[model samples]
Target: MAASFTTSWRCAFLALLALFVSGAYGQLSPTFYASTCPNLTTIVRDAMVTALNPAVGGERRMGASLLRLHFHDCFVEGCDGSVLLDNVPANGSTPAFFGEKNAFGNINSVRGFEVIDTIKAAVEQACPGVVSCADILTLAARDGTFLLGGPTWAVPLGRRDSTTASMDLANRDLPPPFANLVTNPPDGSDLIARFQRKGLSATEMTVLSGAHTIGSAQCQNYRLRLYNENRIDFQFAQGLKANCPQNGPAGDTFLAPLDSTGSTFDNKYYTDLTGLRGLLHSDQVLYPQNNQTQAKIVLKYKGDNTAFFADFAAAMIKMGNLSPLTGTAGQIRTNCRLVNPA
Candidate 1:
């Protein structure tokens, strides 16, 4: 009798563990919309191709912006499309509220909204309220990167959109380019911690940072590093100083390539860090002056593009899996910019 009771208890425990894991992490699928919206991938790709416009340097600019939007959307309150909300100005118009658009990490930084809107409209024409805005954003990021000559990955879908947006959480959770780490010389442990909380590892954090390889940074974002930091490359710093003056002559609108090959997706960003040519302070922190962990990861990617591409695609899937709202938990918004009205 005692042996039978112990066997029953063990089986019950394992069953419960399986249920928890499956319900929590196994909710998304690569073919989630196969029957519901059969043309979802093709639709998103066509929309992205038009919006990205590779013929005129548009793909280079929009690819990074779309990726940034997806990251911003996922990190705050899951990948439920909350980061796309727009609130009314607090000028006695309607009930006043702040949207994630004006959040600290976002504000004038995150773009590709018009492109997302265009994609959403095209998706709606095909499937009409069947596909969710959250899924569209995820697919857009993947397709945008693919069109720009980067590694392609299957984006798991079936995420729902959040009716509410959170500016406060966005400001608090999203890692900035100037966050301090837990180490003496800033080895990027803080950034790692933030990603870790969302189920990402330090190695994955380094892989995602490679997105910087194809984007342009505004003068405002890197001016602090150019003026104050001593670890940046000397000639690179001098060239930046010429465009972005010490005071207010150029202000903050000037643009600088994030990597040597800003228009193409490659391992050059990692090589840039190896030479102390990293643009953002948070970026430089990964391979700090005297670092061990992140520095070695940088060198590995700098040496091998195939390894970098594989790891980056895997990391993106992991990042996309963070805290999704599925199974009737959230609404499918008609317009990504506003919550659907009752």
Candidate 2:
């Protein structure tokens, strides 16, 4: 009888464990938004400008300039994500040629998150305790998406801020602008294996890359795929070398874009990958039908643009949930750039 009781207790414990895992993994609180959300466009744009205030030439790509690119792309049709939005060249000069920092990508974007925190603080100071931190991220991403030719999916508000900042979590959540395909396969495990070691499916990888449709990709991040991938990459190597010349730049850090139209968030990225013009070889792999998961996502993006945006938002919420600080673990930082003093 004692043995029978022991087995029953074990079964009960296992059932409880299963329930916890299911709820934890499925924490899609669509109701999560700010109570007193500020005017998204104006405040976000201002915050981006303030962040770029310190940036000069090389770093200009890191702040206001990047935000404008996002705005330009998203606002093509009253910010409904018109593909007709003009493309801003990463190499834009003050003259008649290019768009500056067109390949700036998410290095500046992650910084934008920090800026959002500061901007949110200002709003909170004025209004006090009436916004959701998650709303800030959601709104910025929405505006950024609209700026890049993506649909503005419904973003629910009411997410509260944790009491802390984590450098590791920030680093882990953001994907490398150029992940080495040879090193990291675009499989379900690609996102998982690198940072959190949680395997995400090929569908996830493709949807996440759509976020790239609006961001920049430096040759420095993706040059190896273009110049060195004789094994997987066939064309564009010689020409790429003529321009890129090294794994990273020799002197100047700033460089050209991987995609010809990285600034505008549109289906162009998928279109380019299909014809073998994908800037990163990892991107090209999506089309070769080699990676089954990636191939499916490529086909989807190649066919429909709206679906990609929807998936990008969904995937972002998923990525954001990775290792979040909860239950008095983290402090709501007064200064996003630094840990809270108290």
For all predicted structures, in order, the TM-scores are 0.88, 0.60
The digit string of per-residue lDDT tens for model 2 on 1-342 reads: 996886565445444543443256443233332334445446755664455444532223343233333332221111111111122334455232221112233233323444555667766675554444444554556555554455544443333344332233333333444554334435522333443343445576666665545444556666666655644335545555676667555512445554556556667778777767777655665576566655667878878765665566555444444443333434444443333345
The C-alpha stretches of model 2 lying farther than 4 A from their native spots are 1-42, 45-110, 113-118, 129-135, 156-199, 231-239, 247-252, 326-329
For candidate 1, the TM-score is 0.88
Computed on alpha carbons, the lDDT of every model, listed in order, comes to: 0.82, 0.47
lDDT for model 1: 0.82
Q: Where is the poorest 10-residue window by lDDT in model 1?
A: 13-22
Instruction: For residues 1-342, write the lDDT of model 1, one tens digit per residue.
Output: 996886565445444543443355667777788898999899998888877786854555798889889999999988888888887666665677788988989998899988889889988999899888888999998887777788777677788999888898888789888864345564544787788778888889899989888888888888889999988999989988988887754668788999999878899999998888888888888886566876899989999887787778777777787888888788999999987888
Off by over 4 Å in 1: 1-24, 54-59, 89-94, 181-189
Q: Which residue pairs in model 1 clash with each other?
A: none
